[model samples]
Each structure stands twice: as C-alpha cells, then as structure tokens.
Target: MYLRLENISKRFNSFVANHNISFSVDAGKIHGILGENGAGKTTLMNIISGLYQPDTGKIYLEDKPVKITSPKGAIKLGIGMVYQHFMLVPQLTVTENIIMGTENSWCLNLRQKQEEIAALSQAYGLKIDPAAQVENLPVGTQQRVEILKVLYRQAQLLILDEPTAVLTPTEVESLINILRQLAGAGKTIIFISHKLEEVINLCDTVTVLRRSKVVATTIAKEVTPQQLAELMVGREVVLQVNKSASVPGKVIVSVQNLSVANDRGIPAVSNVSFQLRAGEILGIAGVDGNGQRELADAIAGVRSIINGKIEFNRSCTRQKIGYIPEDRQKIGLVLQFSIAQNLILKAFKNLPFCHHFLLQPPAINNHAQVAMAEFDIRATGEDIKVSQLSGGNQQKVVLARELAGEPNLIIAMQPTRGLDVGATAAVHSRLLVERDRGAAILYISTELEEVMAMSDRIAVIYRGEFVAILDAEIATIEEIGLLMGRGTGGRKSAGTG
Candidate 1:
C-alpha cells in the first residue's frame, strides 16, 4: 500500500469528528473518500496532511510508519493536499504563487521558475499558463494551477477535497483525465467529495464515512452511485427525482433588462431578462461568479439593481419571496443564534411568534418543534446554536424559516450545497411539493446535474446574460455543457425570449 491509516481518531471538545477510521490506498491508484458534510472525511484528510494531529492511531506510507507533524513535514514526506478552496494568492501569477515559499533567494529568478513549472505542467498533462494571474484565470485553469503547485512540491500522494464542486462539465472531464494520467504515472490520489458520480467514475476503490466512522470500503466498480449514497447517508436515498411533469402557470416574476452589481459595486448581472412562472422551477445554470449570485441577490432584495425592472405578480413586499442564499453560513442563517431563533428570523415580528411590544418564547419553541419534525432536522434542542449543528441541519433550519408561510415565490440558490444525499433528496422533494402547490421557484446553481434534474425550464447564464433558455426535457447535458462554456453551437435549440 502507498498510504494506510490504522485506528485513527480525532475529537473536538465534546464531539468526535473522526472515530477509529482506517483505510489504505495502493500506489498508482485513485482512491475515493465519500461522505456527507461533517462526516470525518475532512478530519481524516487533515490528519493525513499534517494539518491536525490525530488523538489516537497511526499512519503508514510505503509500509513504514511515519509522523506528519506539520504541513512542511507532510510535503517533505511526499504528501500534498489541495483543499476545496484554492490556496494560491489571487493577485500573483501562477509561477509566483507556486514558487513563493519554495525559493529562498531574495533576488528570485521568476522566468526560470515559470519555465520549470510550464515543463512540469506539460509533462503531467495539466496544461496551465504560469504567467497568468490566479484571479484572472477561469476556475478550471486555477484548479490546474493548484495541481501543478502540488506536483511541483514533489508529492507522490495527492489529496484533493471537492475539486470539481465549482467546475463546469468540460472542466470536470479535463480534471478527471489529468488525474487518470497522474495515476498512470505511479501517483497515488485520495479524492474527497459528496458528488457520487465523479467518485464512481474516477476512483478504483471507495471508502464511505458517516458521522465520524467508516461505514464501508469497497471496489468502486462494484457499487452504484445510489448504493454509495446509501452507505454514506445510512439510509435509502432517492437518486432519481420522481416528479410529475411541470404545470407552469402565469408569470410570478418578470425581469426586464435586469442589471445588478457585485459586492464591489461592479456590474455582475447585465441586461438579464427572464420570466418565472407559478408552479415551475426555472433553473439558472452557469459556472461560479457568472452573475448567478448577483441575480439571485437582486431578486431577493438583498442587492440593489442598477437597471431594468423586477415585477412580481403577488405582492410588492419581499415577504412574498422566500430566498435561500448560496452561502448558508454567510447569508442564510445567523450562526450565533439558536435554532429556534434562526427558524423565526423572518417571521419574528408576526403575531404568533411575537405579541405587541413583546416576544413569545413558547410560540417560537412550538413552531421550531414542528419545523424540526417536518424538516427532519437533527439537533439536541431548539435553543442550541445553529453553529453547533452540521451543515445539513443548518440548511434545514434555513429551509424551515424560508418555507414557513409557504411563500408564493422561492429563490433557492444552491439549496442542496454541502448537504448529504439524503438531505439533498429531502430538499428536492420539498421543492417539488411546493411546486405542486403553485410556488414559483428560481433555482440557481452551479451544479449542472442538479439544475438539469430539478428544473422544468433551464436557462443558461453566461457572463451575466441569459444566453439560452430551453425546456429541461429537451435540453441535453452536452448542450448545456457547451452553453456553460459560452459556446455558440447550442443556441439553435434555445428560446430567444
């Protein structure tokens, strides 16, 4: 075996993040670590990469027991970790970012380093421009830079956490190809992700973790995505969405030449116009930072639109719209607040949750109990802070709060992100239920598969414009993939208006 963990465990105060986890990876093979959020996958990887010391157990490389005390030590021991979030400095060029710590000389030879990095990139089939600034490059190219950085450190074993989460389908394919090439060249890879299709497609062997423990370890080809999902979630998970054909009603939301700005006040969404009808899901598919966030924020009344008109059929007030922000911790819920408080965040001023000039704890608690039961939220109590719960549970709290009065319009932005398969299924089912009850859903996600599966009509957003809109049933993944890449080939099948 190239890498092995024996009886490894980790703890954080009262919680056990990883418990007695053991797995082995052979050299020249790609191994997958599958789990939900807070399922010890990250903790195990952290221990392996020397970010955290294990409380108990041991790690062996090449059949020799080893101690990884620090990130530098891990690198010295031929281990490299590419986190879900890239670590490169956005302001610097790829060559500068990669050689920043490795080179010791005050008078650095940047041109020489760039040539070396370019040679490495070419040899490994990981094509990247070493001269390009990290922030200016596309997300896919940025990921290539990350891999090159790891390889440049002379790593034999590479650990990647959710590397494809923000990549387009084409980019994902490119990454998979690169990984396969690396494995072919005698490199060992540990892939961690909640995306089962990629895991099943890329991994030789798979380990499923649930609630800080290993549930199963098996050959990847022997199991389906559904089986892996069940193993990770410890339940029967519905992989395919079972929803009736959409019955789209009158337009619930209309945006005419909508223009919205990003946090820096620069135009992110420009001249984007679309209509969302009642009892239908209009999924906006695009790569990250392609105006999806700004559009969603503009529609949710969180950001001011610079131009165009947003018209609602039901009411002028924002209460008629239920918004689920993309970043759950940052925008969806207050981490410091209790579950009950988060659940009543939008409805706190109402009659049942609050009396005239006073607060109603009992009513709030009662509402929380019902919401918890309905949403299958697992928590110790309503008074526990939302920050204490797992990602899935925190999302449920947001859902409970947003769906309280059954708003006519739902702006769901990455609602199932960072959630387990079971939680994702639950959220999808709830959305479908709401759709059947005549709610207009503006489902915005960079997850193409999800948008394709859930939407009745799919809109391809490229560079802040709605380039194409097509019926989901007729829209193929390849067509959407091309559109997401800003290609002109797929526009023939799209509706202009």
Candidate 2:
C-alpha cells in the first residue's frame, strides 16, 4: 500500500467523528472515499493531512509508521491536500502561490519558479497563466493552481475534498482526466465527493463511509452508481425525483433587463430576462463564478442590481424571500450562535422572542425545538451552537429555519453540494414539496445531475450569459455538457428545432 490508515479514531467533545476507520490506497491508483456530508470524510482527510491529530490510530506511508504532527510534516512526507475551498492568497500570483511554503536558497529565483510552474501546468494540461494574480483567475483555473501547488511540492499522495463541487461538467471532466493522468504517473490519489457518477467513472477502488465509520471498500468497476449510493447511505435510495409534470402558474417573479457588475466592475449578468412562475422549480446551471451569485443576490434583495426590474407575486410580496446561500459558513448561519438563535434570524424582527428590545430565550428555544422536530434537524439540543452540528445537519437547521417562515419564494444555491445520499434525497423531496405547494424556487447548482433531476426547466449559464433553456425531461448529460462548454446547444437542440 502507498498509504494506510488503521483504526483511526477522532472525537470532538462527546461525539466520535471517526470511529476506528481503516482504509488503504495503492500507489499509482485513484482511491475514492465516498460518503455524505458530515460522514467523517473531511475529518479523515484532515487527520491524514495533519490538520487534526487522530485520537487513536496508526498511519503508514510505504508501510512505515509515521507521525504527521503538522502540515509541514505532511508535506515532507509527500502528502498534500487540496481543500474544498482553495487556500491560495488571492493577491499573489499563481507562481508565487505555488511556491508559498517552499524554502529555497538565499538567492530566490523568481524566473526559475515561474518556469517550473509553467512546466508543471503544461504537464498536467492545466492552462494557467503563472503571472496572473489568483484573484483574477476564474474558479476552474484557480483550482488548477491549487493542484499545481500540491504537485510542485513533490507530493506523491494527493487528498482532494469535494473538488468538483464548484466546477462545471466540463471542468469536472478535465479534473478527472488530470487525476487519471496523475495516477498513471505513479501518484496516489484519495478523492472525496458526493457525486456518485464521478466516483463510478474515475476511481479504481472505493470506500464507503457513514457516521464516521467505513461501511465497505470495493473495486469501483464492481459497483454501480445506485449501489455506491446505497452503500454510502446504508439504505436503498430513490436516486431520481418522482415528480409529475409541473403545472407552472402565472409568473410569480419576473426579472427584466437585469444587469450586474462583478467585483472588477465588469458586467457579470447582462440583460438577463427570465420568469419564474408559482408551483415550478427553475434551475440555473452554470460554471462557478459565472454570475450565479450576483443573480441570486439580486433576486433575494441582498445586493443592489446595476439595472433590473423584479416583479413579485402578491403572495410572494407578503412573505419574505428565503435564501440558502452557496457558502454556508459565510452567509447561511452564524457559527457562534446557538441553533435556537439562528432559527429566528430572519423572523426576529417581530416576534414574542423579542420583548422590550431584547431576545427572549424561552420563546426562541421553544420555536427551535418545534422547528428541529419538523425539519428533522439531528442536533443535541436547541442550546447547542450551530457550529457543533455536522455540515448536513447545519444545512438542515438552515432549511428548517427558512421553511418555517413559509416563504413564497426560495433561492437555493448549491443546496446539495456536499450532502450525502440520504440528506440530498431529503432536501430534494422538501424542495419538490415546496414547489408543489406554490412556492417559486430558483435552484442554482453546478452539478448537472442535480439540475436535471430536480428542476422543472434547466437554464445553462456560461461566460456570464444565459445560453440555453431546456426541458429537464428531454435533456441529456451530453447535451448539457456541450452547452456548458461551447454555449451552443448540441444535437438535442437541433432535433428539437
């Protein structure tokens, strides 16, 4: 084995994050760690990467027991981790970011480093501009820079956590190809992702984890996506949504001539016009950073638009719009606040929870208790801090809180990005239920499977432009892939025409 983790256990407070999990990866092979959100996938990777110390376990590199006490130690051991969020300094150039941690001679050669980064990028088919600042690069290119950072450090074992969660289908395929090539070149890879199809397509071997334990490990070819999903969830799961044709009502929310500028003062969303009707789910599918955030923010009334007209339905105008932001930590809920406090975030303005301009803990706790039960938020109690819950459960709290308001419109961005099979299914079911009950939903995600599975209609956004709108029933992965890449509808569109 190139790397081995035996009987690894980690505990936080009273909860066991990893319970005696064991797994191994062979050199020159891509090994997949399959699990749902909060299934200890990140914890295992963190332990291996030296972000956290395992309570009781043995880690071996090339069959030699080793101690990775810090990130520097892990780097020296030829292990590197690319986190779900890129860690590069936004102001630094790509070459500078790649060599951020490396120590060189007193006479540091900038030209030499740039040449090395360029060579590495070419070798991996990563089309990156070494001199470009990290902040100026698109998300796909930034991810490439992150991979290059690891490879430049001479890492033989790479651990990537949810690498494709922010990538479009084309970028995801490119990443897979890079991983395959890396494995062929004798690098060991451990990939963690919720998308089952990618795991089925890319991995040589797979390990399923649930509730901090390894459920099974099997050869990738021996398992189907459905089977892998079942293993991850520990139960039979309905992979597809079972919704009949949606009867879209009158336009509940209409966006006319919408234009928004990015941080660089460039038009991110330009002249965009769309209508979302009551009782329908409209999915916006796009590559990351392709104006999805601007659109969502504008629609949710969080950000001021450059120019746009938003018309809300009478019922929608009466209720506040609920938004589930893409970055949960940054926008969804306050980590330091208790579950009860976050439950009343939006509705705290006017309530019994507010008395004489102060918060009433009793009323807040009671509301949280009811909301937790209704939304199935699996946390210890209402008093527990929001940060204490697992990612899936944290998301559950956000969902429960938002849904409790009985909003007329829901703007969910990447709602199921990192969730496991069971949690994803539950979220999908809830969205469908809300859609059926006359709530207009604007679903945004990079995962094509998710957009196709849950949306009544799918709109492809590319290069900050809405390229094509297609019926979910008649769309194929190939067609969406083409649109995502070329911004031109494929054979499916030709046939429809």
Candidate 3:
C-alpha cells in the first residue's frame, strides 16, 4: 500500500530527533534511507514501526490517516520491522519463533506448524529449516528467519534496519536476492543501511535525512554514491581511503607458529606465523568467528595462547601497545567513566595523570580537552559520561584513549563496525596516521572491502590460518575470496608492500 508522512516531528526532552519529516513511498517498490548517525533515521523508523508516537505529524496509509500507538496496532495494520539486532530466542525453533504471539489457542500442533513454516520459507527462497533451533543456524540464516517472521504475519510494508550489517559477503548476496523477490511479489519495503552501492542497486527510490530533517529524496538510478554520501552528511564526505605509501621499518612483532583457543577451549587459531613491521598496516580479512578475535586477544595479552610464541621487538611492552577491541561498548571504554577519566585509563598511574599516588583531575581533564578537540568528539563537555554520547562520539573516545601516546603497536579490531560513513573515515584516518608514526597495526575486520582498502598487505584468513598474504595493490578480490572460503585454494605468497 502507498504510505506517506506529513510534518512528522518528535522530541525527547529538549532534543529534537525528527523535525518536519515528509516523504511518500509507492507500493511494490524498495525505498532506501540514508543518513549519518544521530541523523534521525532510527527515530523515523521507530515512528513508522509504531514504537514511538510522533509529537506532531500525520501518517497516511493509502491516503488515509491512521493512529499507530503500539506495535500490536502496527502489526494489525500490516506493518512489520526487522531491526539490526536479531530478536530471536536462541532456544526456540524457527517455526516456533515465526508463529510467536500469533497462536490461536493453547492446543498447538508443533509438527504441523513446522511443515507449514517450512513451506513459507521455501516459497520466499529463504531455505531455512523450520524445525532447527535458532542457535544452530548461521547469521544469514537467522536474518532470513527474521524476514520470514514478518512475511508469516502477512505484513504488506516491511521496514528493515541495517539488515546486512552482520552478514557475510555470500550471505549478503543471498539477502539481496531475497529482498528483490519480496519486492517483485508486490511487498513495499523500506531498506535502511550504510552501504551506498547496495542501496543504489536494490532500491528504486533513495531518501536522505540529515540533522533531523529530510534533505533530499531522489531516484536511486539518478544519483551517485558520492552524491548520496554528501547529502546524508550535509558535506562533501570522502568515501575513499586516503593514505600515503608505507615505508616499512624494523619488525615490531612476530608470531611464530602461534595457536589460540576459543572461550570453549576449542582450537580456533591453528599454527599461524606472521611478522608485522613498524609503519605498516597488515589487515586480516575473513568471515566472522574465524579466530580473528582469539588471535587478537592473544596478541594483546588478554587471552592465553595454547602454543607457539609471540615476540615483540624492543620497547614494545604491554603498556606501549594500544588495543582497540571490536566490542567497543564493553571492551574499549568504561561506560560509567567520564571522557577525562577514560582517556587516562591506560596511564592513570603515570606522571602527568597521577602524582604522589593520587589521581590528578586537572591534568586528566586537560588531556581530555586536547584529545576531544583533536579527535573531533562532539559532546557537551569533557565531564559528560561516555554512555551519554552517540556511537560515533563514543568510538572517538576509545580512539582518543588508546592512541594517546602513539603506541608502538596498535591492535584495531573492527574499529568501525557500527559507525556511520563519516565516523568510519575518521577511524581510518587515525589508524593511517598511527601507521605513519612508526607503529605497526594489526587491523582485523570481517569487512572485506575495508580490509583491502586499509591494509598495505592483505592476509586471507580461513579457519584460523592465513592462507595467503598478498600485497594490497596486487590482491585480486576473487583470489582473496577463494582463499577465505577454501584454504590455500588461490595461494598468493606474502608480498613486500
């Protein structure tokens, strides 16, 4: 059905999340939304999905105004939304999850419902096992289950929020095809994502929101990726990686036949050997849960290495290394701490941040002031809590704290995982800056495109082993992908970048 929003506005306390937002989407078409973090994309989506009541606005469905005050009301009106985070119970089967809250009575026929759900899954090209538990399925399969949940409810308009964020490259391709099939079947879809190319390729119309307002809405085929980026950020944003040639220095760290185990005491990283030199960025690329975290944790002295040895060069001590973990909210910063306190976490007992066995508040605050300005952290003040900042600003706090003294080695793991395009660029710029400052950086990420662009030498990791390490400029996408899937399939020797 056709949907329209007129003069949509929402406010939380004194902050306006969405202001005078207006847009119209035709039925049986994929519409894409683009915006930076805190640009009101999520707020607008919440309003559409009936999680929020607009302070002032009118929502029109088929040119008729309707009140959607609760999620049940939205469902009754044939609207459904799948968030970035999966809302499935791991212990439940796919059939159980899809039919939740829709059961007619207490007498439930489990096997019969599973068969029905299986057919529904097959019809949409989902190919999911309705009887299998959700905990046993892959990330992409779980995503398909989410979409199936909405379809099973007979939703006419589906709003997907960053559906492809956690999916692997292969899974992403599958999801794209599934979404195309849905749109072809006359389902109105609103796709929200940070991937500009995917949006342009999938959506018929693209709308951009900036600073809580609808800035531009244009046909997807008529706009370029750079143009959409600029419209979203309200400025000319650089979507490319800008870095100088790496001039390698002395070896900073070397892992010889290193092996690591996962949390369940299972061998995750096999006998892997590699050396990283100063002033170089070596990127490890693979699918998620491919021993990336275990290896990084071992190198950072957090996890135990079951076998082999990790040798650091002179002056590369635990205190001289900067570690930016993938889980920034939990691992990178202390949520209760202020920006000033978190900035001095690594050096709290040192001279400037501490004196005479007491914490130096003035010095810590002074350092935070400088770091916030340099890192471009947009917050009200230095004393503001880290949890109060946006995702981008919180990441900036972690970067500021970790890269304070230019550590000799930097371990950056998925540094820009959930950030917007602008914040991603900032993190890339900072890491490149550290690399230029004679620091060896081990960049671990599941994002293949980002890994290829940021690394001097790209390491294809599969099953906890580096199948091939090719020079970034010479590494072909097909070769890397082959190595990532089948170990040693397209072997490329370690190149001198």
Candidate 4:
C-alpha cells in the first residue's frame, strides 16, 4: 500500500466528524472517497493532508507509521490537497501564484522556474499559460493551474475535493484524462466528490462513507452508480426524477426584451424574453458566466434591469418570491447568523415569526426545527451558525428557508451544485412538489444533466441570448452543448424547431 489510515477519528466539540475510519490506497492508483455532505470525506482528507490532525489515528506511508503535523510537513512528505474552492490569487500571474512561497530570498531564478513549470504542465497535458493573469483564464484553465501548483510542489499523493463542481462536461472529461495520465506516471490520487458518475468512470477503487464511518470499500467496476448512491446515503435513492407531464397553468412571470448588467456594468443579459408559468419549471441551461446570473437576478428583483420589463402575475408580490442565489454564502444566507435567524430572514417582520414591535422566539425556533427536520439538515443544533455547516447542509438551509413559505415563484440557481445523489433527489422532489402546488420555478443552472432531468422546458442561453427553447423530452445533449458553445441550430433538430 502507498498510503494507509488506521482507526482515524476527529471531533469538533460535541460532534464526531470522522470515527474509526480506515482505508488504504495502492501507489499510482486513483482512489475515490464517496459520501454525502458532512459524511467525513472532507474531514478525512484534511487529516491526510495535514490541515488537521486526527484525534485518534495512525497514518502510514510506504508501510511505515508517520505523523503529518502540518501542511508544509505534508508537502515535504509528498502530500498535497486541491480544495473545492480555488486558492489562486486573481491579480497574480499563474507563474507568480505557483512560485509565491518556494523562492530563495538570496538568489531568485524566476525565468528558470517558469520554464520548469511550463515543461511540467506540458508533460502532464495540463495546459496553462504561465504568464497569463489567473483571473483572465477560464475556470477550467484555473483548475489546471491548481493541479500544476500541487505537482510543482513534488507531491506524489494528490488529494482533490469536488474537483469538477465548477467544470463543464468537456472540462470534466479533460480533467479525468489528466488524472489518468498522472496515475499512469506513478502518482497516487485521492479523489473526493459527490458526483458518482465521474468517480465510477475515473477511479479504480472506491470507499463509501456515511455518518463518519466507512460502510464499504470496493473496486469501482464492481458497483453501479445506484449501489454507490445507496451506500453513501444509507438508503435507496431515486436516481432519476419520477414526475408526470407538467400541466403548466397561467403565466406567472413574463419578461419582455429584458436586459441586465453584471457587476462590472457589462450587459450580461441582453434582449432575453421568456415566460414562466405556474406548475412549470423553466430551466436556463448554459455554460457558467453566460448571463444566467444576471438574468436570474433580474427576475428575482436583485439585479437592475437596464432595458425592458418583467411582469409578475397580478397576485404575486415581491414577498411571494423565493430566490436561491448561486453564491449562497454571499447572497442567500447570513453565514454569521444562526440557522434559525437565517431561516426567518424573509419573514422576520411578519406574523408567526414576529409581532408588532418585537420578535417571536418560540415561533421562530419551532419553525426552524420543523424546517431542519423537513430539509434533513444534519446539524447538532438549529441555533448554530449557518457557516459552521457543510456546503450541502448550508444549501439545505437555504432551500428550507426559501421553500418553507410556499412561495409562488422559485428562482433556484444551481440548487444542487455540491449536493450528493440523495440530497439532489430530495431537492428535486421538493421542487416537483412546489411545481405541483402551482409554483413557477425558474431553474437556472450550468449542470446540464440536472437541467435536462428537472426542467419542463429547457432554454439554451449563450452570450446573454436565448438560442433555443426545447421541450425537455426532445432536447439532445449534443444540441444543448452546441448551443451553449454559440453554435447555430446547425442541421440538428433543436429547440422548438
């Protein structure tokens, strides 16, 4: 075995994040750690990468017991971790970002280091322009820069957490190929993700974790995605959405020649027109950063529309809207606030949660407890800060708060981005329930598979315009991909055509 973890356990105050989990990975093999949010996958990886020491565990490298005390120590011991969130400096060049810490103060060889890094990138098929500013490169290229950074540090064992969460399908495939090449060249990789298809496709061996315990460790080829989902969630999960044909009702929202600007005052959403009907899910499918955010925000009344009109149904008011922003940490919830407080953010001044000149604590606490139970929020207490929860749990809190009021129109932006299969299924079910209850759902996401599965009608958005609006049952993946890339209808039966 190249790496071994024995009887690992980690605790945070009253909660056990990891408990007696043991797994071994052979050298030069890609090993996958599969689990739902808060299932100890990240915690275990943190322990392995020396970000946190296990309270009770023994780590062995090359069959010899070793102690990883810190991140620098882990790097020295040939371990590196690429987190889900990129840690690149946006203003710095790729070369500068990569070589930030590893330079000699007396004799700096910047040119030589750039050449060496460039060669390493080329050798690994991780193409990145060393001189390009990090922010100028697309997300996929930035990801490659991250990989190169770790490899440049001379790490033999690479740990990646949800590496494809922000990548397009093509980028994901390219990353898989790069990982394969790395493993082929005698590098050990520990892959962590909620995405089972990628794990089943790219990894050699897999470990399923649930509630901080190792439920099973097996070869990837031996288990189906369904089996893996069941193992990770500890229950039978419906991988596909089981919904009847949507009986769309009266138009709930109408956007006429709407144009919106991004944060930089650039026209991100231009001349986009669409109608969202009650009892329907209109999915806006596009590559990331292609005006989806601006359009969604405009509809949700957050972004200012520079041109045109968005008309809500006569009965629908601003308070009747439930907006789930893509960047939940910044827009959706108050991270520093308690979960209960965040839950009541929309209705703190209204009845059931508040009265006249004061707030109502009992009603708020009871509502929060119910929301937590309904949403399956895995936390020790409801009053804890929302930031303390895992990504998926935080998303659940957003969903719980958003959907609890039974809003008429739901603007769900990337609702299931970091969620596991079971959590995704639950979210889908909740959306369907809302749709059935005559709610108009504007489902905006870059996740093609999800948009295809959940949307009643799919609209392909590219460069701020709706290229095609196709029936979900008839749209092909190729058609959507082509439209997303700014290609014309091109002899393919796409959209309403």
Alpha-carbon TM-score of each model against the true structure: 0.98, 0.91, 0.94, 0.92
Looking at model 2, how many pairs of residues clash? 2
lDDT of 4 by residue, 1-497 (tens): 89999999999999999999999999999999999887988889888998899999899999999999999999999998998889999999999989878877888777887898899999998888888999888778899998888998999999998898767676778899999999999999999987788899999999999999999999998899999999998889999888879998888898888899999998998888888889999998887888998898888898889999999999788888989898889988899999999999988999988788589999999998998999888788889999998888898899988887689899999888878888788889989999999999999887888899998898888789887788888788887776776536723323331
- Please give me the total number of clashing residue pairs in predicted model 4: 0
Spell out the clash pairs found in candidate 3. none
Best by TM-score: 1
Which residue pairs does candidate 1 place in steric collision? none
The alpha-carbon deviation from the true structure for residue 206 of candidate 2, after best TM-score superposition, in angstroms, is 1.6
TM-score of 2: 0.91
Reference-based lDDT, residue 182, model 1: 98
lDDT of each prediction vs. the true structure? 0.90, 0.86, 0.90, 0.88
Q: Cα deviation in Å at residue 112, candidate 4?
A: 3.4
CA error at residue 238 for candidate 1, angstroms: 0.9
Question: How close to the true structure is residue 435 of candidate 3, measured as C-alpha lDDT?
Answer: 95
Off by over 4 Å in 1: 493-497
Candidates' RMSD to native? 1.2, 2.9, 2.1, 2.6
Positional deviation of residue 41's Cα in model 4 after best superposition, in angstroms? 1.1
Q: What pairs collide in candidate 2?
A: 36-420, 37-420
Off by over 4 Å in 3: 485-488, 493-497
How does residue 235 of candidate 2 score in lDDT? 84
